[model samples]
Target: MLLRLPTSVSEAQQCLSEGAIPVGGATLQWAVWQRDGFPEQAMSLREVPEANVLSAEALGAAVPLHRVDDRVPEVLRRAAGGIGTGAVRRSATVGGNIVGSTLRCLLPAAVVLDARAVVLDVEGPFETDLAELTAKRPLLLSLRWRTPQASGYRKLAEAPGGPPPLVVATAVHAPEGARPRLRIAVRDGYEVLAESVECDTGVASVLDALAGTAIGALPAEAREVVREQVTELLARTAA
Candidate 1:
């Protein structure tokens, strides 16, 4: 494999234009390489200054999961901190978590938080929703989102040290004199589903409304688990 390490965003983009695959942390890419062999050309973003930004409202693509500190939202911090073992968290990048799989812990949180990704393609830098960015498989530069009024996250694993079967994230925003708006994202070990609902009556009403929307895509048993966890999350964050 021909590996290129660039120090700036422009240099990285130039390498990308030359058909180099962007790699962050390489934790996920390492697994892929182990299974399918390394790509012909690749660029590591670790040395790119722009890919290391971590602030109150933005995170660079190469920011390690372990560095997701108190500056970001509570739900994001929890998701990042809970991703894997301490060593894995130290080695995994936020960009890798988002691009690697929809089942990744940070993705559902990104969905509910309305995070936008800054991406660089053949056309150059542009911004889009995280979900859309993931679909295009572009080189992610950074992620930005406004802090919500309240947020919560939950994960369900089959056993200790086992992969989580379900991951849920919720964001609540209350407009003056208007009903609170609740947004949710659920990953049912297969797909990430998201929806927004107005909390008109209570958490139960919100649960019932989601029964036919985002939560509906889950199997019956998974649906029940979602209902229970979402109920608890809403009660706390939306209160």
Candidate 2:
């Protein structure tokens, strides 16, 4: 297949509008082509010069805009189970997933943190709510909130030979005086979805509810043996 990597969304869209299938990262497309039919032409946003990937300083400076990442939030030690394999996560990016609206990835984590996505095109820089940006527009950049607290992730796979029917992530934040923040993300039906819960809960408790919500939100046809799987995986990260 022919490959074209554009430096900016306008260029990428230009290629796509011209009939090329522009992909932010090739892995997701590879995942499809590997099991499905042959793809003719491909363009990537990774090699593009104008890609808005951020630096550590940039992540720090964005605090005023989002105000969530003000402290050193605990980095998640464990990730939800059944989210592809190690290789996939290693190469995958927050920007890539958000732009493509790749479900069950990490957008939910950002959403719960009240993160803002920084988007830019030939026009200029714009900020979008993480929840609506991915689904609505071409993602330019994802800026997660730097907050005080901890978070965890969980997921249930189909079986030893199958892919996951559900994935859940819970983010708990210790905002100064208000009730602890609980945010949950679920891998449901065709896309990944999320919701927020206001409570005085800990990270572990938040994850437990998130695990249930993740599975419960799934379509009935998609639920079954995985119920037990959810409990098992969630317990691993449960406090």
Candidate 3:
């Protein structure tokens, strides 16, 4: 069990280039550690200045879930609030939650917000769409977005107020009379996004059109359940 906590970004980069796996809060990393034992080397961004910095334009990779409080936009704040408890939030990071995640709460929220993540490696930083980064599992540095006007999220868990087996999120950018370009992500394990569809803003009509269009895989019953949940989600954002 070897660990290196780098106090600076350059040091962290050096450690990563030397083959150390990055650990933020070590939530998932610990899961891996318990199953497979610690890797030969691991690095922590705990001391880096940008690791947990949060502002209007961007959130640092290591920003803990708890810090993303109500100051965040509703779509993100609402989703972040659902993640475990205060203790888990203290450790789980925005970056850690998105990258290599099986059932992430952030991906759909970020994608619907049109967020971009800055990934760091030996070469340098590169930008990637937040949704795509979930599968790519890059070494994330930060996530940025301009913000969306209308966005919402909902989940229908297997149990009452439990972890959801299905999650849905929607966002729209519309000005004046222009048809809104709706972005949607429906999650089973990973999220599946719809190409921004231009359509009327009538909630029922839009939901009807999108229910069949965005989500590709689902049994008849599950789809109906999603439709009901999405309707409720839109209601919140609209209000």
Best by TM-score: 1
Q: RMSD in angstroms, candidate 1?
A: 2.7
lDDT of 2 by residue, 47-90 (tens): 54445334322231111112223232322223312335656555
lDDT of 1 by residue, 1-239 (tens): 99999888788878988999888778767888989988899987889777788887788888999999989888899899888789988988998888865556788888888889988876677888876877777788888887877888777765766556677788876767877788888877567888999865787788888877857767777777767766776767645
Q: Sorted by lDDT, highest first, which candidate order results?
A: 1, 3, 2
Which of candidates 2 and 3 reaches a greater lDDT?
Answer: 3
**TM-score, prediction 2:** 0.57
State TM-scores per candidate. 0.86, 0.57, 0.82
Candidate 2 overall Cα lDDT vs. reference?
Answer: 0.51
User: Which wins on lDDT, candidate 1 or candidate 3?
Assistant: 1
Which number leads on lDDT? 1
Clashes of 2: 7
- Residue 145 of candidate 2: its Cα lDDT? 64
The lDDT of each candidate is 0.81, 0.51, 0.72
Q: Which stretches of candidate 3 lie over 4 Å from their true place?
A: 160-164, 175-179, 189-195, 199-201, 220-239
Of candidates 2 and 1, the better by TM-score: 1
| Candidate 1 TM-score versus the reference | 0.86
- Collision pairs in model 3: 157-164
* Candidate 1: clashing residue pairs, number: 0
Q: Which ten-residue region of model 2 has the weakest summed lDDT?
A: 60-69
- Model 1 bad stretches (over 4 Å): 159-164, 175-179, 216-225, 237-239
